[model samples]
Target: MSRPRLLPWSNVDGNPCYLLGDGTGSSYLSRVADNVESVQLDMAEELLNHAADLLCDSDSDSKTTSPQLRFLAARLTEALRDVHRIACSRGARLALPDGDDDDDDDDERTDD
Candidate 1:
């Protein structure tokens, strides 16, 4: 049996979703996930740009307000979550090196 793909989005109950396929990316759901991931990454880039602009504004008469900072923090947190999910899903789908599949603990080691 082929390995399941970690879907980009979770279920309505906040659980991670998976797709069992023949390891091909031609499925409709796979294409949709790919598109969603692309949009998510693009949005993250745009958010970072906006954050830089908001943080670099040095006008004394128009200081960054506490509410503005709070809102920015919330948006940043959401973006980070989405990016992290995408990274995990993609990472799980990556092909392992030869003879490297048995060393799952290698990734958990703190020392490089």
Candidate 2:
């Protein structure tokens, strides 16, 4: 029997789950991963917004001792770690800003 492709998420037993797919961006498993990543990112954004609101409040430092604040921070940290792993596994790259230069030419081209 062919070995199943391992998914990004784990099963109930903390074992890696497998799916049938070619691993390309258009594959079924890949699509599922993409959707999951999107939701994870959305959750992260919301969490950050909430945290920001809390921090911006005048009584934020006093409120930080609350259980709810701690829970939110813990959840956000877990989500961050998960998203980082997913990004690494998917080989996602961030485009770096161009250096301070007047020439705005593409790097791929060279003057021969």
Candidate 3:
């Protein structure tokens, strides 16, 4: 697999870290086929399948020299996309612990 094999898009509310140094210089994206996260497990295959397609087809003009690389890339792209959709789609405001904050608060805080 090429570098950055494909990772579930991760959103960090805190400082982010990477496991640099896997022969490819960058960290290879890893995920268990059977994840404990029900959400990931539920959509893993579909997401990877879509990502695999995306990896190959992201650029219409770029001729894919390797089918294996294309498949891996597509699965990664799709997995990241799915992870993004799952982890990021909150309609703007992520309800506070009390679940009682105005939606505008989200925008205002982010703008600051």
Index of the highest-lDDT prediction: 1
Task: Assess candidate 2 and give its lDDT.
Answer: 0.70
Per-model lDDT: 0.88, 0.70, 0.47
Candidates sorted on lDDT, descending: 1, 2, 3
Candidate 2, residue 99: the lDDT equals 82
Estimated TM-score per prediction?
A: 0.84, 0.61, 0.30
Determine which window of 10 residues in candidate 2 has minimal summed lDDT. 88-97
Across 1-112, the per-residue lDDT of candidate 3 in tens digits comes to 2222223334486332222234332323323311323456466776666555655576843755578566666766766666654454322224357656458667556542
Residue 87 Cα positional deviation in candidate 2, in Å, after optimal superposition? 1.7
Better of 1 and 2 by TM-score: 1
Top-scoring candidate (TM-score): 1
lDDT (Cα, 0-100) at 81 in candidate 3:
61
